[model samples]
Target: PFPSVALVGYTNAGKSTLFNRLTGAEVMAKDLLFATLDTTQRTIRLPQGRPAIIADTVGFVSDLPHELVESFRATLEEVGEADLILHVRDIASPDSAAQAKDVEAVLEQIPTPDGKTRRILEVWNKIDLLEPETRETVVGQAERLAREGTAAAVSAWTGEGIEALRDTIASLIDDDPETQLTVEPHRGDLLAWLYANGRVTGRETDDDGRVHLTVRLHPAALGRLERLYPDVID
Candidate 1:
């Protein structure tokens, strides 16, 4: 299956803008805080030719209201279920570090199913708003962090460094090995499940209705399938 990525950050940090820029979708990307109250997801192609699901979530804030957190459980859960978390930051903002702390505080409260920490990549966004010298310095720093597989700098508005961000995400997703399986035909439910949970690249049905599938699945999804249909796996 295609990997999932969740975009999370402080309010007005340009997550929506980056989301739109990356997915080419027109979901509202306003300058106002909390403009995106619901989660929006779109299919995007990673730099390495694999597709992925990318979600834009409501913005975070310091001391996030308990009521809102309770109401937005589903949206927040997307962050927990994501294969990768992109912590979008307004690098041009003076309070960027403090805002990042606020985001980190909220992330800690989310539940991860496997009791394992999710991989996070810092996205230092809005470099287009920086001055020439400052942009150079910030971009250089981000590039160094990216080399270590930790961060990327981009201008959601101007498309700066976006390709590099895509590449980074693809590299991270590809770090896992995918599984291959052939299953019996006429199992509509199983076929549908495979399409929904993984990237199905090939499918064929022979005269007897047997199905052969080539799917690219994350390790977790592969494990789930293995448990469910151990006999079918080959």
Candidate 2:
């Protein structure tokens, strides 16, 4: 499976717009708050030829209601499962900073997998709405995060700074443990499982009915496959 990255932020913070821009999917983006009530997932292809799964979740709010929060636990769990977190913010929003803080608070409440702190890259979004000087200032602030090792800025509507964001995501995902594995034809069940849980790079079937497959899988999947198909791999 493709690695996942979640787009999170306060309601009406342009998270949905950015999600649409990145995934080319239509999942209902509007100017109103809380446009998304559930988690929506789509596939994204990065410039480095690697693919990732992007999840757009319900927008967060300050002092969120317990009922609402409880109802969205499964959706919020998507954030915990993410390989990366794109903290999208509407830079022009007067409460942008406060909104970001609120988002951070909600994220803190979620349980992370493997006890690993979710890697977050703040995205100071909606730059097109800012004045030139303000835009530069915001960019500088976001660049400071990069300097200190954390954030990025972009205008999802205008597609500005998207390339930089994509590149950063590529770098982050590449740093994870990924191994190339080869599979045999008769192991169709294993092959299917690998394709579902890993990224297949190449596959071919020989005249002898053996299959040749190249895949990039997480260490866990690789280990399971090895235990199951010792005779098929090199």
| Model 1 bad stretches (over 4 Å) | 178-234
lDDT of 2 by residue, 1-104 (tens): 46789999988888988898888888788876678988898887786456788999999889777677778899998998999998988889999989888988
C-alpha positional error of residue 119 in candidate 1 after TM-score superposition, expressed in Å: 1.0
TM-score of each: 0.78, 0.79
* lDDT, model 2, position 54: 94
Q: Give Cα-based local distance difference scores for all models.
A: 0.87, 0.81
User: lDDT score, residue 66, model 2?
Assistant: 68
Worst 10 residues of 2 by lDDT: 175-184
